[model samples]
Target: MGTAATDDAGSATRALIFALVALACGHMLSTLLRTIPAISLDLMAADFHIEPQALASLTSVYHFAFAAAQIPVGAAMDRFGVRPVSLALLAGTVFGAVASGFATGPESFAVGQLMLGVATSGMLMCPMTLAAKQLSAARFGLWSGAILSIGNIGMLLSSSPLAFVVDTWGWRAGFWISAAGGVVVALAVFALVPNQPAEHKDHSSPMAQMIEVLRLGLSRPLRGLIALALVSLASSLVLRGLWGGPWLMEIKGLTRVEAGNQLGAFTLAMIVGPLLIGMIDRRIGRRRQRGCREHSTDRRRHIERAGGGSLRRTDCALDDGGHGSVVAPRAGLVLSGRAFRRPSPAIAGDRCRRSDPQLHELLRFAGRRC
Candidate 1:
């Protein structure tokens, strides 16, 4: 009987991991879609009768939309649960990707980008929330890294492979392919992610909840950290996903393939660097000081500060956006992974009584045994 029970537990763990990975692939799709314009900006601009820089700047709308939607998306996941929210987003992504592929004008493409931005804003959070609520902190930490590592793989695909596709079939092929991928991921989520509701639901109006988040974030004590996160996130996205290609191709006079290769190398480093820092963190048990000294770690993760917490506990932003852009993906998984230490005794009591679901959720992620 005992052996059979162990086998059952192992099977459940496997199923849970499959669901987690499928959800993580949504994060991959998010990165892939967001960065698509980087490689093909010139072509897209020419097709739309505009300057390449204009098209590049227009892509910023997507990022703005993405950032804005994260505020509501987290609440939706909390209220409606991750599985439903993920399915809805995946559906939107598929439609948006296909529409973008079919777009013949700048206006249509902009509309498509907006849809995609909102749809994919929570891709990382979906998986992160799932792991946070379902598993022990240790397992959640391991899986969090896995989520980052997997999600960034989309950037890798967007690099050389996407360049090749653009050269051969024109840039539209990328979106069509992504649409297909979205359908596949959606099916996987439907099949694998458990259909359970959130353990603690917040039934309050979303606007009130959002107001609470904004108020907390903008409060005097936390505003500095929020400002720092915003600065760090925007710079990294613009650097890696926007101008990096133009610099390589136009300024350096490299071929498209060559530029993709260069970006691929840098992205590979982006994927590997964080986990290395995280490992050193584990060994020495002192990452916060180093994180501050380097000024190149995850601000949100630092804010969490849970003892032995998962590496880079993040929320209300895209996964990569939550980390130090330089070393974002590389360190996510030795295998997969909060810095928010437990609340103070006074704050902890308030958290239990408050309807501010994020605070309640935050407290639940406190590091504990499986």
Candidate 2:
């Protein structure tokens, strides 16, 4: 048993290391592509003989494609696993970046940007999948934060190192370098990332999974979160991708290189914000727990006074006699007069009967909806 446990631990460690690598690669690819707009905006404007405002639309075009691809890519990862899908997307990155380097007109440039967006879409989901499958629940937050921080390093490099590369070899040449890096990372993913077992596999087809993701994304808390993410991302992209460069160039009267550096600083702040917020969340959660404990004690005293001393020690004692009180230790209270005891077998049976069909119908509807 000990040996088996040791082997499991070793396997988990290996998987985590590979996941970190995958995350790093994803970050690097995303940051590299993200920086391309900032780095190439001036060149694109000159090459296309368009105003900066028109050039800004190209950034929107890329983000539109990127955002659109995420759901489908996530579905594909769920159904097909990450390896082949990731490699294929990386190939798109390579093709798009290299091709964008040679584009002679705005149309071709926009098309190339779209292709890059589609490619980069894989980066957002695949790494997270790998991490979810490999890392322990306790380690997930740490690994996620670390992965994001590593990825943001690519954003940092994009400003300075990319600028240097562009200065030495021109902007088009810098893209060629990114294309080559994509190819290399794709190779690394193939070599290092472990294949997930087919247990409890998604029997749904790709189209079905896509539909389900869309449906789930629209439902309740998930919908609310998705809406928030979309709104936040839209505002962020507008500020960073569309306006950051122009704001620096026009408003601040800075050169492209200087503006890129300033934008890089903003990206760095984004990387830092998650960690800061996580710390705050932990502190707040602790404080809430303490407050909840105090409130529970106060409520228990009140319950004792009301001839319900039975509720004092029980974790989730439910009073069905019109008092409408359920007391939980750490979780929250459900203040209804209904009995909150564990369901009897008959009740469980009834619930299963009702829920199973509803669950099946929901899944079926989702499969059809998206």
Candidate 3:
């Protein structure tokens, strides 16, 4: 039994690791799509005889489609598991990248962007769901951080490395390369990542769970967390998706290659941030635990002082006289039992007297008369 258990644990760990890697791949592809346009924005603008805003709209269309699909894609991930959904999305990404490379006008470019957005939506959620399902709670944080860091590398590559690819063989060549890579990653995910097992098949309807999620979000803490996440994500998206490349080219006056290199550095920093935060969290967690213990002790002491240096105990008593009393040992007083009696105090007193032999014997004649 022990050996079997160990083997099972090992299998689960391996699955979790693979899932993280697959998540990294998905993220890499998404980031690639995101960054490629920025690197080639100038070329795109000049080629299409449009202003920067028009070319930028192409990227925005992709973002809108990607963001819009998140909730539904999450639901699909819950129902069907990561493998099939991820594989399908990856295939879409490849097709979108290839199509975008060949697009001749703004309209065709927008269509490609929308397609890429729809396809890459799966990339964001599936790996996370897979990790949550397969990994132990203790390890989830580490794996999540690892996956995010790895995925950021894709963004990094999209910057400097993509610039190199474009510089060598032109922007079209870069897209073709990305499409080929996407296809390869998709194949890997299909081959290696585990899908939902029969025993763990989803029992609840997707609509029900989605509704529950909506309901839960109405609570204050959930709402707050969601709001905070949205704000942070908005800031990040604006910085990376909109401003990063422009800042490099316009403000820094760097060539596309030099600008891409600068953008790569920014992406590298993003990749490193999670790792640094993880390490800080680990270190701070230990300190936080100790602080919590000390705080608990201080709270206990404060409570003791508030009660005159002694803890108070309260007790209820029912006497033979058919009376109930609330006795506070610290206060040295007993509350009248009238409030506790369901019927008349007289009736309760008589019953209490009858039930207690010591009190009954002491007032036997009186009891008999009653």
Candidate 4:
């Protein structure tokens, strides 16, 4: 009997691991979708008949919508189970990818970004809330690291691979492929994640959960953390997603392919950071708060603080640094210097020539005169 019980426990552990992996893939998809614009901003702007800066600024809507959705998405997870909420978000994500892929103008593209924002807002939390509920601190620490490592693969994908796809097939192809990836991820979640009941016993209305999240954001404990997240993450997102590729290509005189290679290499350290920390946390393991009652506020705070200590990257949406990440992209234009924003009329005319031969010739002649 003892052997049989041990086997069952092992089976359950394997199943949970599989489920978290599937959910983490959703986070990967989120990373891929959001960062694609970074490598191909110029291409997207040319296609949309706008300046690169405009498109970079416009894309901030995705982050805003992402931040705003955190409240309702959290509430939905509380009222409904993580699996259902995740599945719904995945479906929405696929739909948004398709919409973004087919967009004919900036208006349509922004609509798609808004959809993606709402859809992907909850992805990091699904695997996280589940692990936080089920695993001991040591176990959760290890798994959280694994989940982040998986998600960082998305940024890696967006870098060189996406740049190649954009250069060869155009920016639309990138979104089309991502849409297909989203479908695959959804199927994996549907198959691997079991139909579990809502683990949170919050009888409070969904509205209450939403309100509570806002309240906590303002509360003293989290305020400084939130601001620090803002400054650090905002700069990183803007640098990586908004200006890094362009800066390299425009200022450093590197080819798009070369720029992609450098950017891709730069992300390697981030992918590994979490695993190292998780290893240390596992070495300094904590006792069980895995099945502790959340009937009391103190226990809830204890788990939030303790879990956040090592696993903050599970990214609590707000903690994901949404506000700052989006807001900082515009500032990137200023910091990157003048070459990118105005891009000498010659360069603009050269890019515009793809769609208009006459204008390209005119710009070339005009460039000689200047």
Q: Which candidate leads in TM-score?
A: 1
Off by over 4 Å in 1: 215-225, 277-282, 296-357, 363-370
What digit string (tens of lDDT, one per residue) describes model 2 on residues 1-370?
Answer: 9999999989878876875677578667777777666655776688789886787876677778988998888777766677777888888989998878887878888888889888888785666566655544335545556566666666676665666666677778767888888888888888887666532246678787678767755644233334334433543455555566666778679876787788788778867865553344433544324434544664564355344356544424433343322233112322211112222343243453464433222222211111
lDDT of 1 by residue, 1-370 (tens): 9999999999999998999999999999999998888788888888999898888777877888898998888777767889999999999999989988998988889888889999999998898888887776445555666677788889898889988999899899999999999999999999999998876576689887777767765644343344445554565577568777777888779888888998899788767764454334335544334434444344334434322244443343334364344343223211011121223454444544474545544433322111
Model 4: residue 302 alpha-carbon error in angstroms? 35
lDDT of 3 by residue, 76-137 (tens): 66566678888888888999999899989899888888999999887856665666555544
What TM-score do all the candidates reach, one by one?
Answer: 0.80, 0.72, 0.71, 0.75
The RMSD (Cα, Å) of candidate 1 is: 9.3
Deviation in angstroms for 77 in model 3? 1.2
Q: Which segments of model 2 are wrong by more than 4 Å?
A: 1-4, 198-203, 276-283, 286-370
Candidate 4, residues 178-247, lDDT tens digits: the string is 8999999999999999888875546787777778767755644334334434443665577566788888
Better of 2 and 4 by TM-score: 4
lDDT of each: 0.73, 0.62, 0.65, 0.73
- The weakest ten consecutive residues by lDDT in model 4 span 286-295
* lDDT at position 320, candidate 2: 39
lDDT of 4 at 215: 72
